[model samples]
Target: MKLSPTFLSRIPALFLSCCLLLAFGCSDSQDAVEPTLDMDSKANNKSANMMKEYWVEINPLNHSGVTGQAKLVVEGNVLTVEVWAEGLEAGMPHPQHIHGFVENKGNATCPPPSADVNGDGLIDLGEGVPFYGPVLVSLTPFPTAEDGTIHYKQTFMLGMGDMIAYQALKPLQNRVIVLHGMTVEGTYWPTLPIACGQIMPGNSMGMGNR
Candidate 1:
């Protein structure tokens, strides 16, 4: 009718062990709930859908020196502008970019890099509006040599939507497309828009219009 000393001693150790196990068990359970990327499953399901597709038809206005078509694709914030020229030679940088609220081709110069029209210091929504001008995202200058056929592509993420969306919307409201010109000491211009087009929106791809 008496508990053994060994048994009594073992009860406390057993209870302590159980408590430790429960604590660790709950901690492990919580850790498992943390988010984790199912990369394998995603990789299996991933297809062309991840790739963005867009088509922009650019034409020159009030100028005969430059003309052509440009295609673009937006994956997230990065924009890839591809130029397909008819009579353009090879080796030109093209000096191209997106201007916010641009009125005319010869009205202003390409927005200088790190330019903040709103003086907000941060290139966020509404910063590139007041200037309301074109920005040189990327360019393919006049062919350095003679290729006879101009075809160049460039990628850029100028933080436009994140900074100049409001200003960009105005120009975009009227089928604005990509514009190309020249660059001189980060301040070239008359950006004689050589190639131009209207950005058309489709089901899978198109301009955000803002």
Candidate 2:
């Protein structure tokens, strides 16, 4: 038997392809055996149950006269986020954010009533943010109702940059959501956090509570 130069050259390429395929297969096999998102584990990072819900109701801090709730839910590959409130300044655009856990050590808690250490009034956003780290996602604003009710809704992708935040959210027994008032001098109150919510597993809170 005589082997051609071309056949000899092809042998190396073929061998490399087989090796690469074998490596890929081994990696995938290992990954397949691993667990997926754990919905109940505080240590896990992701959860997917179609309509599984997690949210929190935030009381008025800083005496801004605002109260509302933030809800995070999964419908598909996107997370349906909603922040709704009443008692906020009418026609005001509030800046809201999904704050991370405090240093990723544990769940972020809403500042206790005693957090108002100054004895002036309420617990403002500045004082509250430290407990909840930076914004994970700043949602787009929806129109505020004429009656002083503000609503913000946004859907975030669960497969990209948002995936990191979405995954981290599952472990948090507490979620810190902040809404920044428009200006220093609001229609009724000064520019501050009109409303904030400490979200967890639950249904959307009705306006009656705000």
Candidate 3:
């Protein structure tokens, strides 16, 4: 059947209405999807600015009741260290270092007491140096407002040795930490390890800003 002229003239308005409805629906769908995309972008940006935290819980190795936390935050090439301890002798500068070995071959393993092949009744730092790399950070406890207490927090740029350790993708690789007591006259250093902790690794670092 042939449409009347009036009906044909009103067809344009109906077609316009349908077009408007389709456009609105498409716009609503896009609006819904954009938030998830935006959220993902924000998360990416946050990760870009900050790396995953590497944390270590220190426990008494020789000194009883000694407990603390060691935190490392690596942003870019710089590593920030935050270490605090309790049950320590006040006003003492307890030397702490990373004594984990990272190598592809011999002398690359950080051994336990069983490693003392000679059974000389001592585990020398020099002997472990070959196995567990050098002391990456030697911490000095700063005197707190309270008498004889210490709080150690410092930032260090990644050096050649540390950069090598950080590159190791293994969890807790090359992060055996030792907190030593002050040297005493006629006392062998092996007994000085007051507290010990192994720094467990975390997720991979993020790249720069998006």
Candidate 4:
């Protein structure tokens, strides 16, 4: 059946109405999807930045026989840890392993002492050790500063060192930083930590913003 002119005109209105409805639906769907997508993108970007702008700094409090500070900086899987000792006379390479969590700053209790690489609680040392290989940012050993201060810096690119434990640690939490009585070779230190500090904010202080 042939349609009249009036019916044909109505057809245009119906077509337009359908088109408008479809357009509105498409726009609503896009709006919904964009927020989730944007949220995911922001999360990923924040995680990337968290990895990039992480750092830790230690300041020693004494000089007689023990006292020093260590600073750690992590960026995009690369980690740089530096130690400054006031009266570091020097000795054999000491044993250095990421100690477990310490309940108190004055006590000697360490969390189940596993080999933590990232300072994280994970059992794998590969995720935490920055100097293992691709995770190293820089490693520098220097003489005592002009004022009788001992300084050592180590850098490693991402994926280089055994950082298993480091990666297991909770982000932006507190971890222990221990300085052996001697150099970090393979042997354990004396009864307690010669020097120690807490890993705060996962090197976030070094970052310019948040």
Best by TM-score: 2
What are the RMSD figures for all models against the true structure? 24.8, 18.5, 29.1, 26.1
Give the whole-model CA lDDT for all candidates, comma-separated: 0.39, 0.54, 0.47, 0.36
Judged by lDDT relative to the true structure, which candidate is superior, 2 or 3? 2
Clash number for candidate 2: 8
Error of 1 at 19 (Å): 69
Best by lDDT: 2
In the range 1-210, model 3's lDDT, one tens digit per residue, is 122355336444532332343244233323323222132577646644767567666776432356776777776435677776777655433456655433331232433565455676434444444444444444423222134334567766443332322333223444666665433354323224555666765522341111
Q: Rank the candidates by lDDT, best first.
A: 2, 3, 1, 4
Model 4: lDDT equals 0.36
- Residue 205 lDDT in model 3? 35
Candidate 3 lands at a TM-score of 0.52
Alpha-carbon deviation at 95 in model 1, angstroms: 2.0
Candidate 4 residues lying further than 4 Å off, grouped into runs, are 1-46, 51-64, 101-149, 157-161, 182-192, 202-210
Residue 41 lDDT, candidate 3, scale 0-100: 75
Give per-residue CA lDDT, model 2, range 89-181, as digits (tens): 665444565555523436666566676667666565446556655455445443434577866677777434323333444444555776655
Candidate 1, residues 102-146: lDDT per residue as tens digits? 334223222232544455432321232233233423243323224
The count of residue-pair clashes in candidate 1 stands at 23
